[model samples]
Target: MPGCCLWGSAPPAPSGERKGAGWLELLLLLLLILSGWVLTQQPVGCPRVCECFVEEKTVKCANQNLTEVPPDLPRDVQNLFLTGNRLRDLSSGAFPSEPLLELRNLSLRGNQLEQVGAEAFARLPNLKQLDLSQSALLWVSPMAFGNASSPLEELRLSNSLYNYSVVAAIAELLQRGIFQNLKHLDLSSNGLVSLPPGIFSRLPSLQHLDLHNNSLVSLRDVSFGALHQLQRFDLGDNALKRLRNDTLAQLRGLPWLTRLDLGRNAWVCDCGIEDLARWLKESDQVEAKEALKCSEPEEKQNSSLVSLPISGLECLEPDDDQTQLQTSYVFLGIVLALIGAIFLLVLYLNRKGIKKWMYNIRDACRDHMEGYHYRYEINADPRLTHLSSNSDV
Candidate 1:
């Protein structure tokens, strides 16, 4: 229709017709309608000073440079990550009357909190993990952990608190068996001494314990006496002077001991460390069989306490007591062997005595036969005659 100017072409239908575009348009329009309905359904006003933004059911306004506690959260937020915030000093009643916090999987890590209020986390019955690490905490209130005996599976307090009070708090937890189901605990890089008594002992189900870079001097007896199911133990970079035999004696017997890292403790080279060295000799894991010598003070550092490998680390001479111990063991083995040899000698002597008796009986029988039937009764060959016998005629 070159000259007829046909008005029927419909401008080529505006090209780029999307497949199923009508259904997609309908779905988007329906979603918009639903969103409008939801907005209208909200009964109350929006919270002030809290950037309230919701997505389906979650409302997150974390990292708002909050000074006190982050309060007035949504009522149904199941997962809340309050990281990279300025919240400090979570006092009591910080999260009061907040319904969503009760069911939230909260993380308050990397905050500026100096002290955690007592019974702060007493609520939140459904909380699974509470991360308080990297908060630069100076103190921890008693009962700061979960209540009702159902603590979070992973409680991270690394770089959160330290010193005597932290130890005291952990000890208190141990005494009461508060962390019965705690799977992992991170107390690394803290100023801790030996494991506070009753703390590690109470955590029966603990699988991992991170206590690296602590100021642990010695693991005395009863230090790690309880961790029955511990798979990983990190005690690196600590100022450890000794790894006592009794302290780790129970751990050595654990059947599930797979990884033991005692790399940087600088266990002073001495007879005190011999027990571990000897155990490593018969071990299939852990490479501590060599003398664990001191690695500082270049002059006297290379020396070891004694030779556990029978030819290394001969710094200390075998003392009197050591010699006595060796002597006792050697004497015992030698005595047993000597007793066995003596018993065999006695048996041989008994057999020889029986043989001589039979020979004497046979000779007597022959002498009787000769005397009765043949010639002289007691006659004997010249070679067999005794000098003391009467001269034969």
Candidate 2:
């Protein structure tokens, strides 16, 4: 039993720890567990002025009041949360190391961030979701998201943007080949009156666009020219008094546009409203407002849409400019048609005169036909006929 305790029988399996051997084995098991846990909890050295901590495999830091940018975090953390922080400045090399950073989701929402550097976000190679909503971002670097290799799928900047310069900056970046992989973007509750032409010209992958609760007055034609992949567009809560026919018509060409929001607007439901209603009817999805309210007739504004387009009110033409342009197009078309008709008539008359001249020639030939035939007959007789016809002479 001493040397052969192989069963129950194994002497109860050495009831207590076997000193050195048992202690070493237990220590190795504990080390293995700790190692497994370490793979989840990455290194977070800074415990001052920031609440950066490792939660499972994520690095969550938020509600901090740091003035400047934070340091480079653990290279392995995929989800980094710095929401509700007071991060104001964003300089280059302020973000953590990337590719190795492996950041997929980054949340900087509810922060006092005002300026983000140009190359601040370009360093993240694996980033997919970025949340900068509810911040005081006065300006976003036009080239911030440009040439980004990361597959950033969603970007939130609504209710945080404070300036229209952001549009120009974004427009500049788009022109300069920025925002390549961006799919979703939000800029609602901002201050914007109008957008530049060809501003959103290259965002082919952008699907959802939020411009709700903004100060947009009019949506110029071709404003959304490049958003062929757009599925949802939020234009709710704006100061648009009317909708241009050309703008709505061009926007209706978006192949994937499924949802269009026009609520909470000062929509007069006038002729401009008619254009939008027409767009809604032609579009796949839309919702009309409850009713129309008149803007008073013969007002100071020299527009055709003085009275709003109530259900009883007729959908007359809104502004004179749009109608003038339409009239100009029509007049030009009519002029071209008349010119084409004149050309065709002139060609027909020339052909008729030529035919008459040919008729006179035919008459003249008839009169000389008998004399010519007699001369040819005598010349072609006898020896000529025999030589020419049979070579029998």
Candidate 3:
């Protein structure tokens, strides 16, 4: 068979300077290739200072002397490290305004963050771990971490501003169950004096709590009542003088609690401290118990609070009623002895005068008795003579 001529007759092409037209087509194809190459060389919207790893979905922009969050980060970044920067404030949409659906870990440690707005991290829906440690964080809006789409597991706010208002705002969130799924929370070195009652009750999944290096003077029984899953509790380096029985008893309910740090506190080894000492002696989970020294009561100052026996702890001042009763008895005995001594002294000083007055009274009585007897005898003579004559007749 004659080869089937599929291309019987092709349409005639437009006539031009045929050689020049071929050259123009070649030039256009070269330009297109060069443009494609240039576009590939530069990733679209990648921040200049940030180093993005596409395969790992990570952005490492740490310690680059950045004044603010780098703009136009890849939307798919999962881990972002912004540590050691000059990020002063986190206003609304301060970071990349684009939604980051895969972002999980965000670190802002060692920054100068003075304020954090309510929606600062609203674009990150899947954020799980956040580190704001070592920042000069002075203000945090109550809704700063609100509206998170994912369950935040870890939050580190350590060594931030020691502001009560900031802590109270966090407390408000805790009370409202905003961090119910939080597992690890670091609130150390915040100069907190006392935690709000039931502040940690809503976080049922919390495992580790760091409250060390604060000025916490005491804790309420309800302050940690609902933390059943707590494994580690740190109360070290605080200004706690003693813990109440209810406060210590509340800890007994946490079956999973394994480690407790109560060292480096201002413990007072007094009668009121027996419960704490007994608790320490009974529980083996307390770490550094021997280092829990006393900071009050000159007699027990600097002594190991945990080692002191419950019987050895005594009140500096005895019971008021007992003391008053003993004092009254001593005072009464002294007064009675003083009265008796005075009576004896008076008798000894007036002994001669008393004797002379008794003698004079005796002499006058004797003379009056003799005179009465003589008068009676003279009156009776006539009757006696009459009686004798009558008997003789």
Which candidate leads in TM-score?
A: 3
Higher-scoring candidate on lDDT, 1 or 2: 2
Q: Work out the TM-score per prediction.
A: 0.60, 0.61, 0.67
Candidate 3 residue pairs in backbone clash = none
Which candidate order results from sorting by TM-score in descending order?
Answer: 3, 2, 1
Clash count list over all predictions: 0, 3, 0
lDDT of 2 by residue, 86-197 (tens): 7887766667544435779888888867887777787787788988888887777765753655477888877776666766776676666456678898877767777767
Candidates by lDDT, descending order: 3, 2, 1
lDDT of 3 by residue, 41-73 (tens): 556766889877777888888899998888788
CA lDDT of every candidate: 0.64, 0.69, 0.81
For model 3, the stretches where C-alpha displacement exceeds 4 angstroms are: 1-45, 148-150, 317-393
TM-score of model 3 vs. true structure: 0.67
- Assess candidate 2 and give its lDDT: 0.69
